[model samples]
Target: MTKIEDVKLIEIPKVKDSRGNLAIIEKDSLPYPIKRVYYLYDVPSDAFRGGHSHIAQHEFLIPLSGSFDVIIDDATNKKTVTLNKPDKGLHIVPGIWRELENFSSGSVCLVLASDVFLESDYIRDYQDFKLSKSR
Candidate 1:
């Protein structure tokens, strides 16, 4: 079973220059190899996203602009984490349920995924997720 303790906050290395600041995420920095990349943007304040759990996918979430809160549940305990900076990322392991909420306007959430899109890997029902965690 997965636990909230398995979640990690990783600091992305930043290069500061007069022109601008840049942050980088390498394969070695993550627990799983990157196979997919996606971003969330223009989310309304009252909206919620990501009410699902992955059977095998690992993810690293970064707030590139603005901020938001991520609620992670291992079916036994739950925790909320805020992402407000580009230099920080939340590493989410498999078998944990995650929900993204309270997105600030113009927020851009970048997700580095361990695998490509697969419908069969997602557990969309919360009850099903809880049941799976027990087994």
Candidate 2:
């Protein structure tokens, strides 16, 4: 069983240059080996994404551009995180529900996953997720 405290804000190594800055994420940056990489862009400000929890997957979310808020629920408590920096990432473990909202226009969310797409691993219903945590 994962707790809300388990969610963490990860800092990516950033190197500043005269013109711009570069943030990097190597294999050592995460706890799990990333197997899938995806992103979300052009999200409506009032819309939500990721209203579910995974059974076995872990994810690292980075705001590559603009900003957004991630609502994390652990069946016991809920917390909101604001992602506005390119060098910061949110690390999320399994057995916790998450929803992304308040996306600024042109915001891009990059996700690094521990596994390939697996529909069976996702718990989409909020009620079912709470019950699973109690077991």
Candidate 3:
């Protein structure tokens, strides 16, 4: 069976000026066209979120406010990415396990998804996750 991997890190453009900072991720601006969008905010202290992997969904996450660390894993590899800039976000591919951790106070995480919510599309268990990839 082949191993899956997390999405590559793509840098979003930030126009800095005296008027403040501005960032945007339009459908055409992303590596893949976005189909859905969501954000995580008001998270409790030291709370860990996202203990599942998608079977066919592509996700891009950013810390719109403050900062947080994203832990991503696959059957063969794992990585931790820190997202602090609203202009820069992490893109996660399907078939990868992900956990969001180390959130700063009052942090807001914004996510862009490739598909709408489908419970069957998620592989939540590590053991089942590995098996699913082999098929």
Candidate 4:
């Protein structure tokens, strides 16, 4: 079974130049192969997002512009992590509930997933998720 301890902070490689900075994310650098890539932005400061758990999808979240906090619940304990750097990512494994909150204005959240979008893979109900974890 997956636990909160499985969540990790990953440091992405960054290259600096006279123009600006560049960070690279590839399949080789991640624990799992990347199958889908998406980003979230223009989130309101008072709004919250992502209150679900995945059954099989794993994700890596990166703050490309500003900052936010990710609240992770493992059905045993809850932990909060702040993402504020472009060169770092939070790795979320399956079977854990996550919520993104306290997003700063203009923050951009980049996500890389281990699988394609599948509605059947998501556990959207908190009560249902808790029961699944106990089994």
TM-score of each: 0.97, 0.99, 0.90, 0.97
Residue-level lDDT of model 3, residues 1-135, one tens digit each, is: 323343677788877889898886666877677778888888985898899999788899988899988988787677888888788888888888899999999999998998999999998898898777667
Q: 3 or 4, which is superior by lDDT?
A: 4
Q: What order do candidates take by lDDT, descending?
A: 2, 4, 1, 3
lDDT of each: 0.95, 0.97, 0.83, 0.96
Q: Per-residue alpha-carbon lDDT of model 4 for 1-135, expressed as tens digits?
A: 899999999999989999998999865999899999999999999999999999999999999999999999999999999999999999999999999999999999999999999999999999999999999
Model 2: per-residue Cα lDDT over 2-114, one tens digit each: 99899999999999999999898997989999999999998999999999999999999999999999999999999999999999999999988999999999999999999
Better of 3 and 4 by TM-score: 4
Error of model 1, residue 84, in angstroms: 0.2
Worst 10-residue lDDT window, candidate 3: 1-10
Order the candidates by TM-score, highest first — what do you get?
Answer: 2, 1, 4, 3
Model 1 vs. true fold: TM: 0.97
Distance from true location, Cα of 119 in model 3, Å = 0.7
What TM-score does candidate 3 reach?
Answer: 0.90
